[model samples]
Target: MGTWDIGPFDNDTAADFSYRVDEAPDGERADVLLAAFREVTGTGDEYLDADLAMEAIASAALLAAQCPGGEPVTTSYGPKKPLGVLPGELRPPAVAALDRILAADSELLELWEESGADEWKAGVLRLREVLTGA
Candidate 1:
């Protein structure tokens, strides 16, 4: 997985995803994020792979950063280009994608559990809380 930490952009896949987002045109940046989230939420109960989960988590972090209480994504691995304010509509799908990533069949979830990553799990939950504004 090439993961070094629990942050959304801490891994190679997510770092690559950040570049992808940066390369996207300003008007289409939100679409890029939406696509990542949908890749997980649209998979239903299928086993979610780590890379997909990573991208979705990155996307959610970007969206959440725009919320009132949400923290900004200041990591170097996060997108270099500013995404501007994403639409409020993205929140629901971002939450759904997070749910899917934490679900039983998700490879990312299993990997974290096997590694006894309580902090990682908590970070994901924090992302969810930011997304839902709870």
Candidate 2:
């Protein structure tokens, strides 16, 4: 496969971002954790080297540590309720699991940017759902 440019953040056009964010205006850093986790999980193309995956995970952790808000991504679940504020039958157990994860990590809080970390966090949950075959 060829290389892919993830592109750096530019405030003038940040509104067009598809997903992810960093606490500061420097868009170059946002979503490192997500990328790292993706690497850990070995996202996409089976040929991705295991060592690269490990390195990516390491890099992600470092970036997350440097996070301006000191959080990876905000959990959507509320204290006493499940996430997905829709009028339908919610997955009680899934909601509970997500809630637990959120509660355990106060540092996972996220900043509000247009389609910011919330979207990234959702992607994370989606990955878990798929992996667990939920």
Superposed by TM-score, candidate 2 places the C-alpha of residue 73 at a distance from the truth, in angstroms, of 20
Candidate 1 global CA lDDT score: 0.92
Question: Per-residue lDDT for 125 in model 2?
Answer: 47
**What digit string (tens of lDDT, one per residue) describes model 1 on residues 1-134?**
79999899999999999999999998899999999999998888788899999999999989988997898899999988889879999999999999999888999999989988799989999999988983
Shift of residue 115 alpha carbon in model 2, Å: 8.5
Q: State the lDDT at 16 in candidate 2.
A: 21
Writing each residue's lDDT as its tens digit, candidate 2 over 1-134 gives 12121111211122122223323234333333344345434333234342333233223323332333323322221011111121111223223333333332222222212225465455434433432342
**TM-scores across all candidates?**
0.97, 0.22
Model 1 TM-score relative to the real fold? 0.97
Q: Which stretches of candidate 2 lie over 4 Å from their true place?
A: 1-100, 111-115
Steric clash pairs (candidate 2): none
